[model samples]
Structures are given as C-alpha cells and as structure tokens.
Target: MPEGLPLSHAQEALWFLHQLAPDSSAHNTGVAVVIRSAIDLPALHRATDELARRHDLLRSTFAEADGRPVRLVGPDGLAGLEVLDRPGVSDAALRAAVEAALAEPFPLRERGAFRTVLVRRGPQDAVLLIASHHIASDATSHLVLLRDLLRSYEPAAAGGDPTLPPLPGTFDDHVGAERGFLASPRGAETELHWRRVCAGAAPAELPADRPRSAGTPFVGDVCRVEVDPEAAARLRAVAAESGVTEFAYLLGVFQGLLYRSTRQADFLIGCPTTTRLSSKTREVVGNFTNTLVLRANLARGSTFRAAAVSAAEQLRAGVAGIRYPFPLLASRVRLSGGAPLCRLTFNMLNATGSDPLLGLLLDTEHEDRVVPNAGLLLSSLPLPQLGGELDLMVNVRRSADALAVEFRYNANVFERETMRRLAGHFARAIAVAVAGPDSRIATARLWDTAEPARS
Candidate 1:
C-alpha cells in the first residue's frame, strides 16, 4: 500500500457504514455483465489489472484517521480475479455463484475494495461479476469501469495495447477540489439552501406494515411494475404540453401517489445526483453521488400540472447544489439515531433514453466492433437484504416504449404485498394523472386496503 488521498464526502459516509457493518455486503454495489460468448481468460485478467491501474480509487481501501476516513490507493497490479468452472450446473446454481461473488465482503482495511469473479458455464456462456464497495464506486463509476474494462479486454484479446490514455487527474484531484469549495463562502450558501429545503420537513414515514424497529434490518424486497406503453406515451404528451421534462412530471406523480395514499400533505423524498459537475471528473471513478431531497406540499385541489411545474422548479434548484455532500448536509440538519434524512429515495436513470453508461458504451462499440461482443443484462441479485438505511427506494427506468419501476422496501417495515400494492398505486396514479395536469390528485384510485386515515 502507498500513501493516498482523502475520501470524498460520499465515500466517507459509506465508509462509516462499512465500519459499522464490516460483515454485511448490503453496501456492496455489484454489476454482472453477462457474456453469451466465449471469454478469453488471460486477456480479461490483463484488462482487469489495467482497469485497477487506471482508476486509483478502484484499488483503494479505507482507514480511520483521528476522526475521519481516508482512502489508501494501492500500487498498480492485478486487483483481484477469481475464475470458477460451473459446467452442467443448473441455472439456479449459476445464479447463486454470481450472487455469492457479489455478496462476499471486502477486506477494506487490508486489500483493494474492488474484485472480479468469472463464473463460466460453458465456452460460450459466462457471467462477469464486477463488485466494488459503495465507498469506492457508484452507478456512474461502474458504467465508466464497465466501458473501460470491455475496451481494455478487446485489444488485449488481440495482443494489442491495453494501456489507456492517462486521465487528466485522479479521484484525489476531485476530493481536493470539492474540499476547497466547501471551505469557501460558496459552501455556506449551499448549507443555507439545504436549511431552507429541509425546514419543517417530517420524514416520510408512510404507514409501514409492521412496527418500526430501533434498528432497521435493511432487509430489502422488490416489487416491479411496467408502465403501460400507451399510458407512458400519454404522460409524455402531458409533459410536452406543459413544457416540462418527463422526469419532472413522473416525479410529481410519485409525490402525488404518496400524498393520495398516505393523506400526508407535506413530506420529502430524495433522488441521487451525480456530483461530477466537470468534464474532467466524468471519466474518473469514485463515489461522486449526492442525494437531493425535495419537500413536496400536496395541497388539496392542487392540479397535477401545477405539481409537475413545482417539481420541475424544485428539481432544478436541488440539482444546482448537487456538489454539496450528503453526509455534511445530514450533520447540519442535526438528525439523530442514524435515521436517514429521507425515508423514500427515488432515482430515474435513462431519463433521456437508454442507460447513460450503456449509451456511452454502445457508442464505443460502434467504433470497435471486434471486441468480444456479448449480450449484457444488468440485474440485482436476490440475496437477503443486508439491511437498509432508508424505508423505501424506488428506481424508474425508461425502456423502449414504457417506464419500468422497481420498488425496494425494508422487509422488516413493509410486507412484500404492501410494496406490491404501492407499486400498483403508482402505476394507476400516473395513468390517471396523465389524463391531464388539471386532474385532481385525489382522483387517483386505489384499493381500500391501501387507503389511509385522513391525516
């Protein structure tokens, strides 16, 4: 190990949790890129080594300083690679192997926090697992890593150069730049902005199915729904008519769903925003994500269009301060008991179209079609929930002609059917709201089972 840079704000928060649950892999973010074609082991090994060398953070581990966390970037080499043969195994077994690879905990204080496991079912079928501690990676970072890893593998397979052009700077550069900003007057303004956003905000405690526990089990269960394509198109038309982004309208609809279901007039939800405000940081890999909390007051008789417009405005303002670190914001608010500032988190990827990272990688594929082409399906392993910091998480992705929404809830707090019904309410609410922005939010229909006592 060599001397290294300070951890980014996002990194520090996750590192704190990592320290608290050193045995849990709930914080692990794993990406499995399925390759239906044969894999070149030696070439992949070479590419793996190159990728770790390229992103300093990928080869880094954490340690505690006097009172804070620091990242120790390791010298370049093969980070970690494990190859397993799974010939003739059932699909269940193959899936289990992939999940195990992802759930395996990292030796954060001693070894690099990133590793790759290749589970080969046949010469033409295998799954490539890229697992990294959340502290060292994010959705965007994984995309960068996947793109670079595939690119590196292509040429190495052909015995061509695997070396990538050096990045303008490392993750340390980003940490330094962000720290400088926080120490300036601008940082004070950022804090004030958050103060205004969070004042009088109550945590989103949507009536849970079970008693609230002192310690959140973080056990997660998922419920999925696919927005009817025709309905999605209608909503898109509404957004266009209102001159607001589709995401703005969808977010408003989500808020409306919560309001109609829980009968709460005011509450908060959050969406993760990338902190990479500069092109230079785009290619750098690290935990550069911040959660942006938006407070919504669903006044009686408020039209969906008005809500959409309000949401769009708040979204713009919230993103403007995306550079503000979430951990610091949590502290400034003086929230205690390790309860997350916001209980419901929503993220919309593919807002423009396909996944941003996949879009970038697809473009690269056009230039170099010779890479070991493989069909990649990104999925989350159905492993036991490591535990959750939040009560609910909703992820929305736009597909060919519809929006797919997945609701992940704390199993201890929410029954699987509870989440399932919530998903139904969301889909129905969006469909009804799309009829026109003037549609009353209360008109969104739901079963009596989910209706709440008026708040």
Candidate 2:
C-alpha cells in the first residue's frame, strides 16, 4: 500500500537512529550461530547472493554528505562464504574462530553494514559465522535472519525463488512519520519531564582495575552466579507476596546489594527495555530497545520488600517514558554535567522461538557465548519453559573477582567483588521479603552452584 515494506515500529526506531548516529544502540549486540556442515560452495554462494538481493538493508552502509550521515544501499561486496575446515579441531578451536571473525574491526564507512565469514572446519564440519555491525541491526534481526536462512536451507523447503510479502511502507516513510510526531507540543513536554527527573543526577564513576587504552574499550568482565533450587522456591513466594514482577523485585534486591556493597548514596544502573508495544513490533524482529538508568538511594533499615516496591514503581514509570532518550537529558538536565548516565546495564530477555538452526540440525553438543565487553552484564538466559524456573547470570571482571555494583565505590569508587556478593544478596533479599512475616527470610539464604540446606 505504501512502498516496498512498512517497517514495524521497532524497525522504524532503529532506522531513525541509524540515520542520525550510525553508532546508535542498533550496533550493540552481534549474533553468531555456529553451524557444522559440509560446505556447498556453489549452493551457499547462490543462497547468499539471493539473500543480499532480497534484503537491501543487509547490503547498505552509512555515507557522509556535507558532514551528515546517510544510508547507502547498493550491490554488496561481501566475500564468498568459506569453510573453516576444522574437523578434528576441539570445541575451543571452533569458538576461537568465531571470536576472531567477530573481533575484526569494521569501518563505519562504505557498505560494511553486514558480512558473513564461513570458516571451513572440515568437509562435514564448518561454522557459519555472520558478523554484522549493530548500527543497522539488532539481536532479533539476527534470530529472524538465522531462522529464515535455516528454513531456506532445508531440502524440502522450496527452492529457486524467494517471495516476501509486500511491505506497507518503506523504512524512510516511518522515519518521516516519527519526525512529524517529534515536532509536536507533547513531544516537547516529554523532554521537559525527563529533564526534571534526571536533574543533577551524577553517573557512577568507575575506574578500570587496569590502565585504560584508547579507542572504544569494551569492558567484558563477567562472573556467572546461580541460585540453587530451594532458594529459587523461596524467591518465588516472596515475589508473589510482594506483588511485583521478578524484574522489580530483583531490581530492589540488586540495588540493596549494590548499596550494601558500595555505600554509594545515589547511582545509576542501565537496563534494556523491549520497547515493543504492539504485536507487529513484538513479532517483527529488530532492535526496538531503549536504555534507562535505574537510580537508587537506599535508606538504612528499609526492608527488602519496601525497596523492591520502590524499584517496581520506578521501572513502570521509566518504561512509559519511551520518547525520552538518554542523550536528550544532556540538553535538558542540569548538574552532574558530562558524567555518564550509567556505567552498568542489565538485559532480561525471554526469546523463545524456532531455533535459528532448525533445518541444518548440526549437533550443538558444546555451545558457549562470547560477550567480551560490557562494564557489567547481567543476562537471564533462555531456561526451561516453567513459571517458577529462572536462571540469572552475573558476569563481572575476573581479576577484580567482583561485581559491577562493587566497583561503584572503593579503591576507586567501588569494589567489584562486593557488588558480586550483592548479586547473591538480592536472592537473600527476595527470600526475606517473600518469606512470611512469622518466618525469617534472613534465615532463608540462597546457595550458589550447589544445593542450599532446608530449614
């Protein structure tokens, strides 16, 4: 009706930022799907060529005109997909190849939007490595692309021609629509409100344990900590009794953990918002996320339940303020000038869909993720499909042997391990909050890795 294809709201949002800043949130995470299969050099090439022709965005890149950035689409100049040839190579070999392929620096200019590097591990074992710069993509995009490509690779799944449903509007149309909306009176008010909320808020200044280097320093320090089954049960009851989403309850627990660990009066923590409102945006994959700083000021003696409720209310309010960007606050808010809004970020994603590599069913016996960067990364990875079951991973600096909250204040401004200890502390907090008043959650502690004792 409108044009080639109408981008869902999330796609439009990403396109909006891609047009403005080529290095926006769109370029945050890169997805790598390790596939082991005999390389069909000719077949794969044909498929990739078709894919590049079918999706213009995948072949497009950013260009500078009069010092302004613009999207440039044309015939892609990508290399032919190769086989890594690692037959006897250990799991570590496959992993290192994937990481090396991803670590290759991408220039912001030219048609460097996305590229696929095929490592031929062996005749029957090869990894399909795809590394796309985030400026033009998101995690959902990766999942969708991977899933679609796998479907196409199926022997029975139709061959030759690929037919995509007609799109209602082009990405540019959505961009125009958003531009018109941002020019409204309500839009201006949204700016003012955020200004008030963030006025004088200072960033959590965290110094690297080691000397810093130039260029974008990716602090991918991580620590994996899990709560035993019994502690998880206790947390569930407390979350239910508190009447808050696990996110909110966890936020409260996390804040208390950070405060107890760092003793910082005020600080900001970052978290990713799905930002997908309607079903279209939700299902249509792309980066439709906004990062917000969850500020906490723990009052001494405040119960964990009270702290959790406070955290819950703030998240509710913050998510509603989607139109406000962190950068906009720079123009509106006063005080704490030039300080980072947040140094730590949290992402709680629940993506359950057709496995990206369903067709080529390669035996994925050993799987590991490489996220070597993030000042502080917290991920609630895909777990068993059950209501009470959840796995929380806290990855911090290995040498610092601590958590992000710990680095809030200490030898520098925070100590790392203390923050990690707080991650455990949150579980303890939830156990306490949800434990009935007559019962003591203080006694209900979370045991990591192994099983905890019963009362």
Please list the C-alpha lDDT of all candidates, in the order they appear: 0.76, 0.49
Error of 1 at 378 (Å): 10
Model 1 scores a C-alpha lDDT of: 0.76
Deviation in Å, model 2, residue 235 alpha carbon: 3.1
Once model 2 is optimally superposed onto the true structure by TM-score, how far is the C-alpha of residue 231 displaced, in angstroms? 2.4
Off by over 4 Å in 2: 1-28, 36-43, 76-83, 155-160, 166-170, 204-216, 278-287, 330-337, 351-455
lDDT of 2 by residue, 1-455 (tens): 11133333444334455555554322334455544334446556655555565556666655555544455666654523545555677867766876666655555455455666666555655566555654555556565555444434443233444333433333444344445545788668776666665666664433334433333223332333544345444654676788886557667776655555445647776665654455444334334455666677666655677777878877876776665555445434555645556655544432223332321222122244321111111111211111000012232211111112111222222245644554555545545555532332223344453542322
- For model 1, residues 84-147, the per-residue Cα lDDT tens digits are 8999799789989888888888889877578888899888777787788877877778778878
TM-score of each: 0.91, 0.71
Top lDDT prediction, candidate number: 1
- Model 2 TM-score is 0.71
